[model samples]
Target: MGYPGLHRILWTREQFAVFRDASGQSYVVDAYCPHLGANLSVGGRVMGSCIECPFHGWQFSGKDGKCTRIPYAEKVPEFAKIKVWPSCEVGGMILVWYHCDGVSPTWQVPEQEEVASGAWVFHGTTEHFVNAHVQEIPENAADAAHLSFLHEPWIMNGVDLRHTKSKFWRFMKHHWKAEWQPEPDMHCSCLIVKHSLTIFGKHFPLLDMMISARQIGPGLVFLIFQHDFLGCGVMIHSVTPVEPLLQHVTHRIYYQRSVPSIIPKFLLWAESIQFERDVMIWNNKQYLSKPLLVKEDAAIQRHRRWYSQFYSENSPKFPSQNTGLDW
Candidate 1:
C-alpha cells in the first residue's frame, strides 16, 4: 500500500508506487519517471515535502508535483510536474485515483451525512478487487442460497453444510422493502426475500429500510438500502464498474450505537473478514459462463433488465428523483 495508515495497501495492476509524506498527505505517482524512464518511487528521496529523483536528483514538490530545484537551475519549467491524483481522507481511509484527464470531476464520492455528521458508532473501510463486473459483486448481498454454503455460520447450528432452496425474491413492482427473515430483535415479521439478517456482526436483527435500485449511468450504479435501526441509521454503497470485469465497491457503514467501543475489536475483525468473503466470491466468478438459473434468478433478471436500460439509445434520465413508485 502507498499509505502508511491502512492495515494493508496492495499494489497491483499498473500501480507502481505509493507514499505518504511528513505532512500526512498521501500521493500515488507514476512508477517510471518521465525524465529518463527511471522509477521515481524506487530509491527516491523524501525531504520536507519533496521527492528527489534517484536518477538525476531532480527535486519535485510533493504537494504540487512540480520539479522545484534541478540541483543547479534558475527556474522550474511548466511541464516539470508529474501526474498526481487529488486525494483526501474519508472514513479513516485515504483514497487517490490516477486520473490522467485534468478535468476536475464532480465529486462522485457518496454524500454520506451519517459518516460526515459523526453521530454513529465505529466505522471502517477497505479496498478490494472483483474480477467480475462491479454490478455483479454486491449482487451476492441478495443471494440467499450461497450464504448457507460459502458462509457456514457456526451461529446457526445445523444450518451449516446444507444448501437451502434458492428463493426467488424481490420488491413488488411497487416500492421495495428488504428486511431480514424471522424478524429482528424489535422483531418485525414482515420482510421481503431480498434481505439478509443483519446480525450486529454476523446474522440476525437485520435493520429494516426502503431499498431503491437505479443504474445512474453506463457502467455506474447507485443502490440505496436505508438502514433505519434503533433510531436513525443508513449507509449507501456505490458500486461502479472500472472495466467490464473490474469494480470498485465502497461501503459507507453508518450505525447508531450507544458507544463507539461497545462493539469489541473481535467483532470488527470478524466484520472485515465477512466483507472480504464477498470480494472473493465475486472476483473468482466467471459471469459469462452459462449456468443454470432457475426461477430463483428473478432478482438477477431484474438487475439485468435495469442494466439493459442504460445501454438504450434513448435511456431515460438517471439519478432522477425516485417518484416513490418505480424502484
Candidate 2:
C-alpha cells in the first residue's frame, strides 16, 4: 500500500524466524520443509524457478511447492513433500496470506493505482526493522499528537500541532485513519491522508499518510506502508515468540516526492533525516514496560488501542517455538 516494491524482510518477531523472499517475481514458501522439518530458509537458495534446500540438495519449485528434482532421489521420492505459498509482486510489494492453518483464504495485498502509475513519480524504497509490532506502527499514520515529540512539527512545513484537528476515521474493519486540520501558521497549509481504501472508497476511509516522495505529480505520495506478512509478526511474518512480552519488528519505507520543483526532493531528504531520529526514539522505547495512556500519547495510545485487536496473549496460534534457536 505504501510503494510498489517487494522487500524480503527477514525478521525475528516474538523470537520467531521469518524470511520475506521478495524477488521481482514473488513466490513465498514456508521457511521449513514439511518433510524433514528442515529450515529451508536457513540454507534455502533461489535459482531460476526453484528454491533449493541446502540439506541433501533437495530443490523445491516456488511455483506450487512441487519438488522439481531431488539429486539423490531416483524420481524425487514420494515422501519429499513441501508446502508452498504462491505469492506475487504487483506494485513493487510482495503480498502473501498469513493463515497458519495452511488454508489460503480470499485475502488481497494492499495496492493503489498511484503506486506505479505513470502519473505519479516512483522512487525506490528503503527497508528497515523496528523493535515493535506492525499492528503498533501503522497506527502512527493516524497519530497526530506524536508529531510534536517524535517528529519536529516545525520541520513539517510548520504544522501547528496546537491547532490541528483530530478526527475519527474508519477505512475497514482492520484499518483506521485520522485527519488533522492544518493551521494558518503551520508550514504545510493542509494535512490530508489518502491511503487505506475501504470496500469501495467511502466504506474505508484512511487519511492517506503520504504514499511516496519521489516526485511531484497528481499520484506522487510521500509515505506509504503495507504489511508484508510474507512469513509472521504483523499477520504471519512474525515468527518469533520469546515470552509474549517482547516481539521483533521489520518495516519498509516506500517514500516519494509530491511537488514538481526541487523542493520535493529537499523534503524527501529532510524526511530521511527525521526518519533516523524517529528510529532512535522508537527503538529505545521500553516496549515491554507498558505505559498508561496520556494526552500527549494520543496517537501512540491510538496505536495501542488499534493493536489490541490482536493483543490477546492467549490466541491458540503462537510462534512455532521450533526455529532450532536456543534463545
Candidate 2 C-alpha error for residue 2, in Å: 22
- Local distance difference test, per candidate? 0.47, 0.41
- Deviating ranges (above 4 Å) for candidate 1: 1-13, 16-26, 45-49, 62-64, 98-104, 121-135, 141-257, 260-284, 289-327
lDDT of 2 by residue, 178-287 (tens): 35332232211122433332432354333223332121111112243332221101111111322332344322333333434343344345455445555555556544
lDDT for model 1, on a 0 to 1 scale? Answer: 0.47
Q: Candidate 2: which stretches are off by over 4 Å?
A: 1-9, 13-24, 31-48, 53-57, 99-106, 127-129, 133-136, 149-153, 156-264, 288-303, 311-327
Give the best candidate by TM-score.
Answer: 1
Q: Against the hidden true structure, what lDDT does model 2 obtain?
A: 0.41
Q: Which run of 10 residues does model 1 get worst, by summed lDDT? A: 166-175
| CA shift of 293, model 2, Å | 3.9
